[model samples]
Target: DSQKEANGLRTDHWVMDKRHSTYLFFMGVGEYAIVKDKWKNIAVDYYIEKEYEPYAKQIYGNTPEMIEFFSKKLGYDYPWAKYAQISGRDYVSGAMENTTATLHGSDILQKPGQLIDENKWEDTIAHELFHHWFGDLVTAESWSNLTVNESFANYSEYLWNEYKYGKDQADYHQMEDVNHYIHNPSDFKKDLVRFDYASREDVFDLVTYQKGGGILHMLRNYLGDDAFFAGMNDYLKTYEYKNAEAHQLRLSFEKVSGKDLNWFFNQWYFGSGHPKLNYSYTFEPVKKQVTVIVNQSQELPFEFPLTIDVYDNGKPKRQQVWVNAAAKNTFSFDVSKNPDLVNINADGILVADITETKTPEQNLMQFTGSKEFKSRYSALTAIKDQVGKNPAATKLLSAALKDPYFRVRQKALELMDLSNADQLKALGADVEKLASNDPKTLVQGAAIAALAKTKDKKYLSVFEKGVNAVSNSVKANSVAAVLAVDPSKANTLADKIDLEGASDELLSQMLPIIVKNKVTSEMSNIAPLVAFYPFLKFQNPELGKSAEEGYNWIMTSDNLKATESVTKILGQAKGQMGENPQVKMMISQMLKDGLTKKMELLKQNPQKASSINPQIDAINKAIENFK
Candidate 1:
C-alpha cells in the first residue's frame, strides 16, 4: 500500500500472503520505472531502469498474454493479488519466482533494436511464470525432489514455445536441452530424484532441469495431452499452497489416466542412467519379413516404449514396441518388399542415445520423407561428416540449406565445409543468397560465417550491409566477415557496432577481433565484457582464452587513453561487485595474477619498465581497492 502525505512524501507498505515458502519471498527497493498493464483487473507490471522506459513494453509486453495462457492451460486462475517483475542491476541468476513478484537480471532491459530481432528472454519469462503453478502454488516437498519445481518450469519453455511459435521451435529447444544433459556423460550417472546429493546446489544440475524436462516430455507423449494436463490440474489443486513430492505427482497422473505408472516412476525418477541403444535391421526376402534388432549396451537395461518406422516403397508403417529389461530384443514385421529404411525412435521422442544402422541413401530418404524436425535433424547429423566425401551426402547438405525449419537450414550451413574450393564452388552462391535474404537472422549469420571461411573479397558488400542489420547476430557475423576480407577496417567497424543489445554470440565473435586488432575504442563497454568473464571461463573455454587476451591487451596497451578507461572501469566494477563477493574475489585474483605477469615482463626487459610501471601501478591500486 502506498499513500501520499500532505507533506508530499509517499509511504509504502508490503504484506505478503501466508503459507508461501520462505524461498519464494522477495523484496525489491530501488528507483524503478514502473510500466503498467493488467490482466482481467489484475495488475501486471514491469519495473525497469528509467533509460529503458520506452522499451519496457517491448521487453515484457507478452507477460500478460503469457499469464493468461498459463492460467488457462493449467486450468487455474492467477491466484495472487498482482504480478510484478523487477529487473535488478547485476542480478546473480536469470530469474526467480517469488509468489506475485519475480526478479530478473538487468539484461532483460533491451533496446528496440534487440527486440526487432527477437525477445530472447521470452522463454525465461514463461519459465518463471509457469513456476507460479508448479513452484509457488505446489511447492516441492524437499530438495531431493526438485524436479517437482524445476522440471515443470523447464518443460514450460517447450510448452510455451509450442503454443506461441510452433512444434519445430519447441523441438529445437528440446533438442538443445537434451544436448546440454548428454554432453556431460558423467551427469548421466545421477538419478532425477536423489536423496544423497552433496549439497542443495548439487540438485540444480542438468539432470534436474534438462533431463527432467525431457522425461516429462516423454511422459506427456505417453499419457497423451488430455490425461497429462488433467493430471497436472488435479495435482496443482490437490497441493496448492502446500508441498508435494515426485511420487504424489505420479499418483495424480495415474489417477487421471487409470494406468499404473510405477514402471515409469521407478525407472526414470528413482533410477540412474538412460538406455544406450544400438539399432539394426536384417531383411529376409524369403520370409518377406524384416527383423529389427535393438541391443542395449548399458550395464542396466531400461524398459521403455520404442517406435520404429518401416518405410516400404517410400511409405511408412509405424510399429510401437516395448523393450523390456533385456540386453537384446528383436521384432519382425511382415513387409511387401525390402524395407527402404528402418528408422528407430521414429518420432525422436525418447531421450536415450541411439545409434541406428542406416545407409547414406536411407538417411537421405529419412531426411526428405520424415515430417518431424528431430528425425530430419538426426538424418542431417548422421551424414554431416560425409558432406565433402560422398555425392549423396553432398547433395543432402545442399538440399538442407533450403529446409523448411530455420534450424535445419542453419545446421546445414554449419555443416558445410566451405574451406574446400570445390565444395564452396558448389554451394557458395546458395550460401551468399541465404546470407543476404534468409528470413531468420540466425541462419543469415550462419551463412555469413560459412562464407567467411573462404576469405574472398567479392562478398564484402554483403557483409557491409549485414553490419546494419537489426539482429546483433547478423551484425556481429558481418563484422567478422568484413575483418576476414579487409583487416584494416577492424577498428572502424568495432567503433560502429553498438554493444548495448549484444548477444553472447556477438560478444564471442567481437572479443577476438577486438583483441587481435588492438581495438581499444570498446573500453566504455568494458562492464559487459568483464561481466562475461565468469560465464565464458566456466561454460566456454575457447572464448575465455580470447577474453584473457583482450584483458592482457587492455592492461598493457601502448595506448594511454585505453589504459585510463580500463582503470576507471575496473574501479567502478569493484564498487559494483560488493554484492557479489565471489565475483569480486575472482576479479581481484585475476588482477593480481595479471600484475604478476606484467612485473615479470618488466623485469625481463628493464628498458620497458618506465612505460609499463604506470600501467602496472594502476592495476595494483585497483586490486587493492577491490580487496
Candidate 2:
C-alpha cells in the first residue's frame, strides 16, 4: 500500500507471509521497470532494467502457464498473494526462491533477436517457481535432507520440459543432468543424504541436485505415474507450511501406495556409490536361448529393476527382471533364433555406469529397432568413433542425422568427421539440408559448423544466409564460417555484431576467429570476450583456453586500441571482484605479467617501441589501479 506524506512524497508499506523462513526474505531497491501481468486474480510482475522492458514478457511470458501447470499437477493452489521476479546485476546465483518474489541474474534479459531463437532462462524460471511449493510451502528440515527442497526443484525442469515440449526434449535434458553427476568423479562416493558433511555448502553439489533428481525419476518409474503423483499430493498436503525430513517424505509415499519403501529409500538415499555393471551375453542356438550376464564391480550390490531388450532377426522382445543383492547375476531368455542384439538397461532408467559388449552390426540393429531415446543414443555413441573407418558405421551415422529427435540429430552432426573427404562428400547434401531446413536452431547451427569445416567456396551462400538467422548460435557459427571460407570479411563482421549477451558456445567459436584475423576494429564488442575469461576458466577448460588465447593476443598486440580496451575492462572488473579476492588477485597478477612482457618485447624491437609505448603505459596504469 502507498500513501502520500505531507511533504508530497509517497511511502509504501510491505507485508510478508507469517509462515516463511528467514532465508526467503528479500528486499530489492533499484530503478527498475515493472512489467505488470496477472494469473487468474493474483498479481504477477517482472522487475527489470528499462532497456529490457520491451523484452520482459518475451523472457517471462510463460510464467503464468507454468504456475497453473504446477498447481494442477501437485493438486495444490498457489499459496501466495502475488508472484514477482526481479533481475539483479551480477547476481550471486543463477536464481533464488524468495517466497513470492524470485531473484535472477541480469543475464535473463535478452534482446528481440536473441529471444527469436530461444529463451535460455526458461528452465531456471520454472525451477525457482517450483521452489515456491517444494522449498517455501514445505521446507526441508535440515541441510542434510536438502533433496526434499532442491531435488524436487531440479526435477521441475524436466517436468516443465516434458509438458511444454515432448518426451524427447525432456529425456535429452535428463540425460544432460545425469551426465553432470556422472562426469564428476570426485562426488561419486558421497551419499545423497549424509550427516558427516564438513560444511553446509558441501551438500549442495551435483549429487544433491542432479543425482537426487535422477533418483526421484527412478522412484516415479517404480511406483507408476498415478501412485507417484498421488503420493506427492499427500506429502505436500500433510506438510504444508512446515519443515520435514527425507524419511517423512518416504513415509508419505508409503501411506499413499501401501508398500514398504525402506529398500528404495535406504539403498538410494543412504548408499554411497552407483552400480557399475559389466554386461556380456552368450547364445545357445541348440536350445534357442540367450544367457545374459551382469557383473557389479562396485563394493556393494544394489537391488533394482533392470530392463533387457533381446533382438532376434531384427525384432525386439523386452523382459523386466529384478537384480538381487549379489555381485553377479545371470538370466536366460528363450528366443526364436540366434540373438542379434542383447541390450541391458534398455529404457535407461537407472543412474549407473554400464559397459556392454556388442558388435557394430548389433549396435546398428539396436539403433534401428529400439524405441527408447537412450537406447538409440547409446548405440550412436558406441559407433561414433568408427564413422570413417567402417562403412556400416558411416551409414548408421548418416541415417542418424535425420533422427526424429533434435538432440539425436545434433549429436550425429557433432560426431561427424568433417576432415574426412570421403565421409563429407558422401553426406554433404544431407548436412547442408539440415543446416538450411532443420527446425531446431541448435541443430541448424551444428550443421552450419560441419559444412564450414570443408572450406568449400560454394557453401558461402549458406553461411551468408545463416548470418541473418535469428539464433545467436547460428549467427556466431556463420561469422566463424565466413572467416574460415574467406578471411577478408573478418573486420566488417566483427564491427557489425554485438557480443555482449552472446552464449558461451558463441564466444568460444568467435574468440579464436578474432585472434587469428587480428580484428581489433571493434574493441568494445570484444571486451566481453576478455572479461568472461575469469568465470569461464573454471566452468569450461577448453573454452577457457580459447578465451585465454584471445586475452593474450590483446595484451601483446601492437594495436593501441586493443590495449586500451583490455585495460579499461580490467580496471572496471576490479570493483566488481570485491567479494571474490582470489579472482581479483588473479586479474591483478595477469595485468602485471602482461605489462612486464610487453616492456621486454618493446626493448628488443626498438624501431617499433615508440608506437607501442602508449600501450605499455596504459597497462601499467591499469595494474596500479587494479591493486
Candidate 3:
C-alpha cells in the first residue's frame, strides 16, 4: 500500500492499460459485488496484477452472456467487443451505464446486513447489464434523449427481472421508485438528466431511471407488448451503431405503433414536470349505489394505470381499470343495489395524490384486494402513510412486512414511520419475522434496522437474535438501524456483534451505523458503537478533518494513487515546507494518485476536464493550503 502511494499506480490504471483505448472505458473499484465471484467463469486473480483484477474479472464474467443476451433480445448481435463495470464506495446515485463500463455506488454491495435489502444490488447488476443493449449499444444522441438510454433499461430491467424472478419482484421495484417518480414527475430530486448538470455521479438521479422506466411502462401498456417490442427492435435496428435523438425515436415509434406518441412522450419525458390526475368517488344513496370519479390531477399528469376499487355496503367488489390521459373520465362497474363506498385509484395507478375518505374495514377490502402483490403493496403503503391516525394501517403494514419480494419488504421498511408504540412494535416484529423467513443479506439488514427502529426494550431479544451471527455489512446496517431506534440495546448488541477480519470499507460502513445513532445523542447513547468499531476513528479530529471533503486525492494524500500526503500539514513531514515531511507525503501521494486518476480521465478524454476537476481541485487545495 505504501509503495502504491509513491508509484502513481492504482487498480483503475492497470485496467486502462489493459483496455486498448479510452473511448469505451470507465472504471470503478469497490466491494459492492452483489454475489462476489458469482461470475467465476471469467474470474482472474485480482491479486496477480491486483489493481487490474476487478475490471478484468468483470469483463471476463459478463463477456459472453451479457453480449449474447442483448444480441438476440435486441434483434441484433453484440456491438461492442467488451464490457466492464464497478461500484464506488460512497456513490449515492443509482448506477451509471458508462459506454463499456457501468459504475454503481458502493452502498449497494453488502455482506448480508449493511444495506436495507439486496435485490436492488442484484437488480442493479441486471439493469446495467440490460443497458448493454439499450444505452450502450444504441447511444442517445443528446442529453435530452437520456430517456432513450434510461427508460429502455428501466423497463428492460423490469422485463428481465420478471423474466428471471416473476412479475412480483419487478413490480416491487418498478411500482415503488417509478410510481413515486411518476407521482412527483417534477420532483427534481430524481433528476432525469443526472448527466450534464450536478456532478458526474449525480447523473444517477431517480428521474431518468424511475420515471423514465414508468413512462416506458405506460408506453408499453399503451402500445401493447407486440407493438412495443417491434418499436424497440426497430429503434435499435435503425439507430444501431449510431446516435439517436429523442425526436428520432418518437418518429420511429410512431412508425412502429402506427399511433402518434407526441403527446405522451412530451408530457412525460421532454417536459420537466408531472401531471395531476384527480380521483373522486361518492355513494349515490338515491340511486341505491355508490359513484366514483377518477381524473388526472391538474398538476402531475403523466399517464399510467388507474385501478378503481368498488365496495357494496363497504364490502370490496372486484373492479379494475386502465385509465389513460383523460381530463374528466368516468367508468361505472357493477355495484350492489345499496353500495356504501367507492375508491378511485383503488389500484393506486395514474400519477396523482390520493385522499382517502373511507374506513380501514372499507379500505381493507382495497388493502387486501385480490391478494395481488402490487395492489397489496400499494394498500400497505397507503396504510403506512396514514399510520398516525389509522390504527388499522398496522395490520396492512404487517401484511406488507410479509411481502414475498425482498424489494417490497425493503420499501415497507423505508415507508413505515416508527413513531407510535404499537407501530414501532409492529415494525420490530416484522423485522424479526423476516430475519427468520428471509435469510438473505438485504432483507436481513432491513429487518435489523426495523427492529432497532422500534427502540422498544421488549424487542431487544429480537435485535439480539438478528444482530448476532451476521455479515459485516448486514450487522452494520442492522446495528445502525437498531442504534437509531434504541442506542442502549444497539450498544449491547454491537458489543456482541463481531468485527474480526472485516475490511476497511466494511468498517467505514459499519462504524457510522454504530456511532452518531439518531435514536440517541449522548456518548452513553453510542457507547457500544464508539467501543467495538475502529473505523469509528474516522470521526477522530485528525482523519475526520482530512477526509471531510471526500476527494480521493485529498483524503488519501494521493490524488487517485492512494498516497497519504495530507500527513505533511500536521507537521509529520520529514523535510522543509514543500520539501518537508507533509509536502513530501502530499507530493508523493498526489503524483501517484494524480497519475491514476488523471490517466484514467485522460483515457476517457482529456478534453473534458470536468470529469477530473472534482479530483484535481480537491488535491490542489489539500496541498495548496499546506504552503
Q: Could you tally the backbone clashes for each prediction? A: 0, 0, 42
The stretch of ten residues in a row with the least summed lDDT in candidate 1 is 523-532
Q: Where is model 2 more than 4 Å wrong at Cα? A: 4-9, 501-505, 516-549, 552-589, 595-627
- Could you give candidate 2's per-residue lDDT for residues 437-548 as a string of tens digits? 9998888888999899888898999999988877876887888888889989887777545455676567667776666656665444566666557667888787777677
lDDT of 1 by residue, 13-131 (tens): 98776578999999999899899999999999998889999988888998899889888888999788899999887576689999889999876878766776678788888888889
Give per-residue lDDT, candidate 3, residue 255: 95
Candidate order by decreasing TM-score: 2, 1, 3
Against the hidden true structure, what lDDT does model 3 obtain? 0.55
| Model 3, TM vs. native | 0.62
RMSD of each: 5.7, 5.3, 11.9
lDDT of each: 0.84, 0.85, 0.55
Candidate 2, which ten residues in sequence have the lowest lDDT sum? 516-525
lDDT of 3 at 257: 84
Q: Pull out the clashing pairs in model 2.
A: none
Candidate with top TM-score is 2
